[model samples]
Target: MNIRNLAATFVIALFGFFTLNLGLDYGLRNTVPHVLQRRLLNRVTADVVAIGNSVIASGFDVAAFDRASGMHSINAGLGAAEFAQQYVAWKLVTNERTDIKQVVFGTFDYSVTNTKPTKWTTWHSNNALPFYADPSWSIRYGCASRADEVVYLLARRVPLFTERGGLWTKVETLRRYLGGVGFPAAQINRFGRISDSKLLLEQNTEVFERLGRSIVETRVPLVDPVADLLKEAQQKGIASFMVLMPLPADRRSFYAMPGWKAYVVYLRELLSQTGTRLIEATEWSDSREDFADFVHLSEIGAAKFSTRLSEAMQCAK
Candidate 1:
């Protein structure tokens, strides 16, 4: 073909491909986010909706808490979520369920920041697209950079080149495929998602904690966006509280880099300034045995904390 014809064909194909990408992103139902959207969109009126990162996502057992508290609840925790995504979750839950009398936000050192790859990973868009159709969500929930979007589409969705996660998870996936079985039970429900698995006995907590600390400290800090949301909820007469969820006592000292210590101090000041009710992880002291990881509570831990949270709500009431 002549150069002109070849270039024209290339342009047409590119446009078609881009259109297809858009269609797939919006049209197809997202696996994880859809669950959350359905939970919120359902006509159920929950008294407490816990929104945070993975800490509470899989950590809090909403059903157990509901049984204990005698109040409806839901856990809207996203894995690897930072403040921006959690705030969106908060908005989503409250907006959909006006009967939400209280909101329990799971706050950590980095819960107020966007340094996490919410945009690049399409975590935000995955949740927002189902209910929030605004074009702005493309930037808010997706990679703002067109170049990055191209890369994500190529890497994540393209069949031959999907992200396989860590080496162990890869091995686990292969094991399941080869062995005609599945990974150990991953229980997800409208209440929440929690793996029944326990944290590995010899897991290298220190190294992972250090790496997490390093990445967080290098990013520019953000103001406590949750504070504003809480303030609004309070104004609307929606009771609200914060949970200063830190790593387990054993690993906290090792994990809290200098910057993290400073961030905690700042967080405390912010809470004091706003008069936000708080449930610090240290207060209850979840046993090290109850953790599935450095912070996420296991099922037994979830049972314990869910009861504690229920009792706390009783006191609040």
Candidate 2:
């Protein structure tokens, strides 16, 4: 063959190889976002759907809530998700399913603000074409629209950015699963007895003060399209509520910036204007040890907190 014909043949082969690899990657990683997992909770149907970031994702157990309240529930939490991304996800789900009688949004300081957009990783988009169609949002424009796409596409060919944390967590999860232990039990038990609660509280207060400063500087407006959606839901006889997930005890002092108290008061007042109830899980004193991080729940903490949430919901009803 001539050189041109030879080069053409090599190019065609390379294209075929990439297409096949991307297909495999999508198959392995793509699953519904945890927030959308409400479809599988039970045959009984849920009266409520909870949505938020990692705190809501790792901290709330829908199955336990369902059993405790006799109300089917689904936790649609996303990890590391900012409000803009979350708003898109919520819009997509509610647009498709109208039966979701209520939505419980786990509000947090960061959830109300915007952040620099992150690049779209293959793990997040799952090789889905539609994921790239909308590029107007500030976060999408910042992260996905840069030359990073070329880097991501090339990295996929080499498995250079494979999810190490997810893989390790999955293995740990499987070990627990095979041993017939329930979720988060091992992590919770690792802490042992809980006497020095005040020590952790002091630490948390510092963290909260720092977080509060960020909130004030960004002035990122609270993103609650849910008020409009709730109006539609109420017209159709549905209900909605917003819950502010608790922080570690020391978060308040650690993160106590100038506007922190005012911000909290603002959130409460905003919820009232929309006629949606607010549940402050942070008000409970015994709730701090359940956290896996400063903000997320260890599995044991999630179960305990979910039970408390169920009880609170019942009282609200």
Candidate 3:
């Protein structure tokens, strides 16, 4: 190609890229949910803050917990968040707040042990945006290598890179709406869509059984970011507890496995070293009607579970 033609093509590409980035930055910053999430992170002052992935987001009934415990609480859970993102949410929400007396982390099998940093291009990036936007934090907890650190640092400065997840979120939202158009309307709450929590132990029994067996066989170890969360909470004199959120009947049966029992014993020992209590609420709810899916609690279940959690906390105190 001619030099002039190549130059013109390059200029057009640059302009398009700049315009796309500008549009994405504006759209992501102004979205209602994103704005509200930011507001919650900055303004929420509660006696308790619960942080985790979607399980906590969809399962923790903040209002029920508040009513039952007579203490205000915020569910700072983020869908698809990993341990690093969960830690970031806690840090951002509790950074200057002295009113937060306790922090509850909702976890399931191997969640605490999975320390993989979220990708900046996927939907999960939205959950980790607060920390990934900061080069230092992204470097400290996100990137696994020097090359990754460089990319994270660059993504921190570029809206096109960092907000890719927001764009994907928009896409997913549209897809869900379209996909559900012909189906009966889904039951949704403030947390999002709810699945019918039925007590069908036979449904997906094999999947859960295999998952349990795999977990028992793999025996993953705890990672640094999770340990950091517990240690930091201890250092700040805030109570930190990791609750093993309710599981389906098929999944719960794995607890009886000898390997799984041994793994839990080791996990408890590690948690004790950091003064973090591991609360096993796995068998808290047995009925399938309490679950939104295989792992999360439905609205009814969330209310019931939150009340029980409040009682558990009171007894712990």
Q: Which candidate is the best by lDDT?
A: 3
Superposed on all Cα atoms, the candidates' RMSDs to the truth, in angstroms, are: 7.3, 7.9, 4.1
TM-score of each: 0.63, 0.62, 0.81
Candidate 2 off by > 4 Å: 1-3, 6-10, 25-44, 115-220, 224-238, 252-258, 285-289, 314-317
User: How well does candidate 1 score on lDDT at residue 111?
Assistant: 41
Q: Mind giving the per-residue lDDT tens digits that candidate 3 earns over 1-317?
A: 99999999999999999898888778777543365357666675688889887788888999999999999898888776656666777777777678888989888765676545555334244454553433454356655578877776666667776666667767988999999998998876544554533332324545545544565567555776678888888888888888888877767666665555665676787788777777888889988889767668888899989999988877766
Ranking by lDDT: 3, 1, 2
Cα lDDT of candidate 2 equals 0.56
Instruction: Indicate the TM-score of model 3.
Output: 0.81
lDDT string for model 2 (111-205, tens) is 54434444445344212221422333223422454577555455534321432223445576677578845535433322322333223333454
Candidate 1, lDDT over the whole model? 0.59
Clashes of 3: 3
How far out, in Å, is residue 271 in model 2?
3.3
lDDT, model 3: 0.72
Residue 100 deviation, candidate 2, in Å?
Answer: 1.2
Q: Which scores greater on lDDT, model 2 or model 3?
A: 3
